[model samples]
Target: MADNTSRIVYEMTISHAEFFRTLPAVMGALPYVVDGSEVSALQDTRRLKINLSPEGRRNFGPIPLPVTHVELGFDGYSHEETQAFL
Candidate 1:
């Protein structure tokens, strides 16, 4: 693992409701530290929520409709090793 901390930033478009619904599955695919947080929102909508977990665990309900896009941000160490893993 590299000493430097890095962040993974990406964008996705999804409905407000759908975003909340799939939050858990999305977060599960990410490599967060033991304790981490996730901040989410809808495009152009004022609705937003921030969830924090000391164990880096996230739980989101099922989304009925499709999510348009989503913006994902992750921060952690092992910056150099990440590329090889990907």
Candidate 2:
């Protein structure tokens, strides 16, 4: 077990609900499992705080090259659960 804590800052233009769903997939692709407790989502501001681990670092292996910015398209997933919580 390595006590390695890393911080990754990503600029994702996604809604709050969409981010909740997509985050799992994105984090899953990383080498480490995200510590949800340390995850902070500020959708209103389009900001996300993710506390990563060694496995995450190993999996993601640093940020992408050139660091191109892109927009994410959200489907019905955003509204599907809206009414449930309301």
Candidate 3:
């Protein structure tokens, strides 16, 4: 398995309105993990560069992989469940 422990994490936030509007688009961007603590409704101005080792490339695909639009899929969650959680 590829080693993913060396990845750089950048935490950011946006308005609740903007987040909702962009959530679908964001979900299609890349391979990432979402943590409860990482959710917020305020803007955070911070950025970081990611340096991927060979193993990271194998795990995450190419460094500049193009993302095609994908329909959002919410598995096993009702509308109310998703709204309440968000």
Best by lDDT: 1
Measured by TM-score, the strongest candidate is 1
Worst 10 residues of 3 by lDDT: 48-57
Worst 10 residues of 2 by lDDT: 51-60
Tens digits of per-residue lDDT for model 1 on 1-86?
Answer: 33443444333334455545666665464433322245643323222334432222123456343323332332333545445332
User: What is the per-residue lDDT of model 2 for residues 27-77, given as tens digits with 9 covering 90 to 100?
Assistant: 443233324424544333233345422221112356332221223222222
TM-score of 3: 0.23
Q: Which ten residues in a row have the lowest lDDT in candidate 1?
A: 66-75
The local distance difference test score of each candidate is 0.39, 0.36, 0.31
lDDT for 36 in candidate 3 is: 31
Which segments of candidate 3 are over 4 A away from where they belong? 6-13, 29-86
lDDT assessment of candidate 1:
0.39
TM-score of each model, paired residue for residue? 0.33, 0.28, 0.23
Off by over 4 Å in 2: 23-86
User: In candidate 1, residue 12 scores what lDDT?
Assistant: 34
| Residue 40 C-alpha lDDT in model 1 | 47
